[model samples]
Target: MTKFFLLLSAAAIAAPAHSQTSPDSDAPEVVVTATRAAQPLSEIGQAVTVIDRAEIERRQTTVLSDLLATTPGVTVTRNGTVGALTSVRIRGAEADQTLVVIDGVRVNDPSSTGGGFNFGNLLSSSVERIEVLRGPNSVPWGSQAIGGVVNIITAAPTEGVQARANAEYGYADSVFASAGVSGKSGPVSGSLTGGYLRTDGISSATSGTERDGYRQYGATGRVGVEFAPGIGLDLRGYFADSRVAIDGFPAPDYVFADTPEYSKTREAYGYAGLHANLADGRFNNRVAFTIADINRDNYDPSFGNDPSFIGRGRSERYEYQGDFRPLDQVRVVAGVEREDSRFNDGFTFADTGITSVYGQLIVKPLDVLTITGGVRNDDHDDFGSHTTFGANAALALRTGTTVRASYGEGFKAPTLYQLFSDYGNRDLDPETARNFDIGVEQAFLGNRARVGVTYFNRRTRNQIDFRDCSPSELTTPGSICANRPFGVYDNVARAEADGVEFTLALRPVDALTLTANYSYIDTENRSVGDDFGNDLARRPKQTASVNADYRFAFGLSVGGTVTVVGDSFDDVGNTTRLDGYALAGVRAELPICERFAVYGRVDNLTDTRYETIAGYGNYGRAAYGGVRLRLK
Candidate 1:
């Protein structure tokens, strides 16, 4: 690693001095909300990755899991096809350690015991791009950002009236269709998008017949108006509904005659915001409000005596943010947000609420050096208050290389279900972590090729986990051990994780582009007990991926990618292990004319049946072909 850094430093110094400058006379820049300010990406002293729309379409990726799998230091597990639950891990951290944001609004539910966002029901067709920031982001974002933050930015209206429709059919008798329209008129602009997807699912061993699988429908609408020269108003709304059949675990002795179960879920989210310029346009400000509602119903006839588990949750949030450029090179940002959440479950559980306030500053002392700092305070109705802070600095040497380092602290408050659920324990405390990272980035081949490498380390204390307890110690005083309920939430563990990641992107030629990413992690969990420390579950020791895209003459383009994941543990006991696997995919696009095009994709071309989630099976080879129509 030291050698790599030295080489990068040397290259950074030489490239700028020898290269010819562009007419723009400015460095390429990307705007991000990493600091709660629209600052350039190059100035942020952290690991950040951006996925644009063109790449999304090129890969024919239809879900968050698909996109995350390609990002550096990130891993995703998919249970099956549409509507199946999906989870993500960053930098060897657990799912709950990552924070998810949609258009600047937090999507994680405070009532969920899992403490993570569920992407099973999210509609990806409306997403324009995604920004992924790795490392502790809790100081700028809130709790649950110990590992990182992922922000999904939706698309806005275009300049002229435009419309498009797409449809695809694939293996397992799956089908999908979507249509969208967007345009600008005078000072008003609007966009509307909708889609439907369905599949019959592959055969399951537990069920003699193929499972019912899933079907989903969703719609999104947005409208924005420029009320004044430097002012705007925007309103956005979205709804999604899905029906999924659940194939429960195999019966004792691994019988395969059980009928498939089923469930239904509905979700709706909406937001409205106003933006304005202040201090003669030197400061930009935004005030926004959002609401989200979710309902889920499950039906399992096999559990004859058990009552159905039904849940309904609702959340509302309000935010006010301001960005001020006090000087040419100094920017200050501050924000305050409040969230109120309520849940009604068939079982007994009380309503819960959480609120937070945050502030940040970014300063550039020299053209090549930038510094950032931020802090946040959060108050939970049940856990009182906790604070987190972060600091980072970046230096760009005269050579074409940049170096950055950062340190931060994060905390995750106990959830309502963890404290007050039917099987919950109230003695559990919040989890906390302190993390640090350092990295370097270098450009070569006339800026057409870029290489980046980073090293990250994190130490977490008072981690929450389940512990076996005797029946007599329970509040209800039942035979808990006899019932085989071996776990209860408690703070009993400390964990440490360190990892190195490398990424390379090269446009070898104008018509071809290639990219590669690799990561290696070392993780350990220390629990005061007879058991020795072990590697954390579901965190692969090594992972790598490579992709290439080529454009042929006559408006034809093709792309391919291959991914490899190393071995990992399945559970805390470390008794179960998931084997490594590799998979490949290819896609092609042909434009028949300016107004129409056709595309096709083949995934898991090798028909690899690998378990991303231990004990759970993944889908086999699948293929999809589609056509798109454009109108202007």
Candidate 2:
């Protein structure tokens, strides 16, 4: 890690030293995840990545997690094929520490072991845009932002009537189809999209022979009505039902292998809100209600006809937000919210609630500078109250350069599963962290080339981890694990992560675009145990990706992508090693008419053998083709 940083410093010092001016004329991009309100990307100090619908179509990626893995400071690990257990880690933080929001509603599962959102079931077909904040910002987002935030925004109303559809088929007898429509007829505007996917996948275990399969049906919709010039009502909803074959250890062998086991999951999220613009749109206020419901079931045909396990989780939230701009240079955003969570495991039920109030102040002290500060207070039913604060600043110069710095604090309350599951420990405490980062960006060559680099550091305490029950404790009277022979959850871990991210984009010509990024993260386990000072499990220290796309004069486009990942330990003890690997793919599209087009892509061109999770199978060389139709 030290050598890597030294090389990075050397490269920075060797770069050309020259004065440049801002020449770009394109409109500035707008993002909402950083501040929970629409703000120009250049005015925010936090690191953020935006992937739009055009980019999604260009990549030809059906699974959202696959695309997210290529971004800087992000890592994804899957147990098996599509629809299997998948986890996303940001900057070496645990999966559950990252908050996921879909269409303004939190979608994390309260019944899961870690209460994290599963990215495996998320398809990119209905998504219109995604905003990823790369560091802790709990002050505005509330709890579970210890790592970062992933905000997914779906399709919205369009100006005129429009419709689009796509269908694709590929390896493993896979099939995918989707359609969407959006328009505004009178005072009402609405959009709806639906999709389906099915694939005969490979075995979950590396050495297994039997093939597993997966199927999913999903949909999203939004409707809005403008009653008057300053008042409106909006509604949104999302739904998905999926099933995937899984492998388990049979009694005879008690080893990881293929088995007649599978799991089914259903997720539904909904939101309704009323908004009013007062004082000539300077004071905007909104009141909203949201809910997330999830159900999961696992079955083992070899054992019985009924499901062997069942789990359910739900979240209901009431929120009110108001943002006022009393002066042209000053803006204040404030919000109050209450959330209730419930979980059931077919045997016992548990619930919890939290109330939070937060506010932020945005000040443009000068024409070239902007500063933001925020604070939040949350009171949990079991954990009492906690407060957090965050602040950031951005400085832009006419020389086409920008400098940013930020300090943030975050926390994550214990989930119902951790506090009430079979191995639960009611004494578990919430996780907390402190984060800091600074970065600079520069654009040159008539705004055709751009480069940026950032450095971040974070420290976390009271991290909850699974602890094995000792023989003596299991048999002792009145012990914490007196009757629990397996294990228990406890807040007995600490961690620290520091990393550097570098990004580059070049549009050397009118028809070609090239982009690349690299990240180096150094993570350590600070707990007092044998794994002390060791690297975190399943987190790569280095990751890099490069992509290039070109369009011809006759409506033909071609592109390719390459991703490289470095190796790291699979466990905290560092007893198992996972090797590094590379992936490469190519794609092309050609228009057949004004409203129709054909496209194809070949993934895993080299068929590299690799694994993100130990003992899990990974896909190989595969090919796919599709057709698209659009009408306006």
For TM-score, the strongest prediction is 2
Candidate 1 stretches greater than 4 Å from native: 1-29, 203-209, 250-258, 301-307, 471-487
The top-ranked prediction according to lDDT is: 2
lDDT, each prediction: 0.76, 0.89
Which tens-of-lDDT digit does each residue in 50-134 have in candidate 1?
Answer: 7766677777777667768877899887655557777888888778878887766677755466567777776567777788888
User: Cα deviation of 12 in candidate 2 (Å)?
Assistant: 24
What TM-score, computed on C-alpha atoms, does each candidate reach?
A: 0.91, 0.95
1-632, model 2: which lDDT tens digit per residue?
34333333332232211111112337788899988988888889999888888778888879999989988899999988888988999999999999999999999998888899999999987999988898899998998999999999999999999999999999999999999999997889999999999999889899898888999999999999999888999999999999999998989889999999999999999999999999998999999999999999999999898999998999999999999999988999999999999999898799999999999999999978989999999999988899999999999887889999999998999999888889888877789999999999998888888899999999999999999989999999977788898999889999999999998877767677767789999999999989899999999999987676777899888877777889988889988899888787778889999999999998887788899989999899999999999999
Distance from true location, Cα of 293 in model 2, Å: 0.3
| Residue range with the least summed lDDT across 10 consecutive positions in model 1 | 16-25
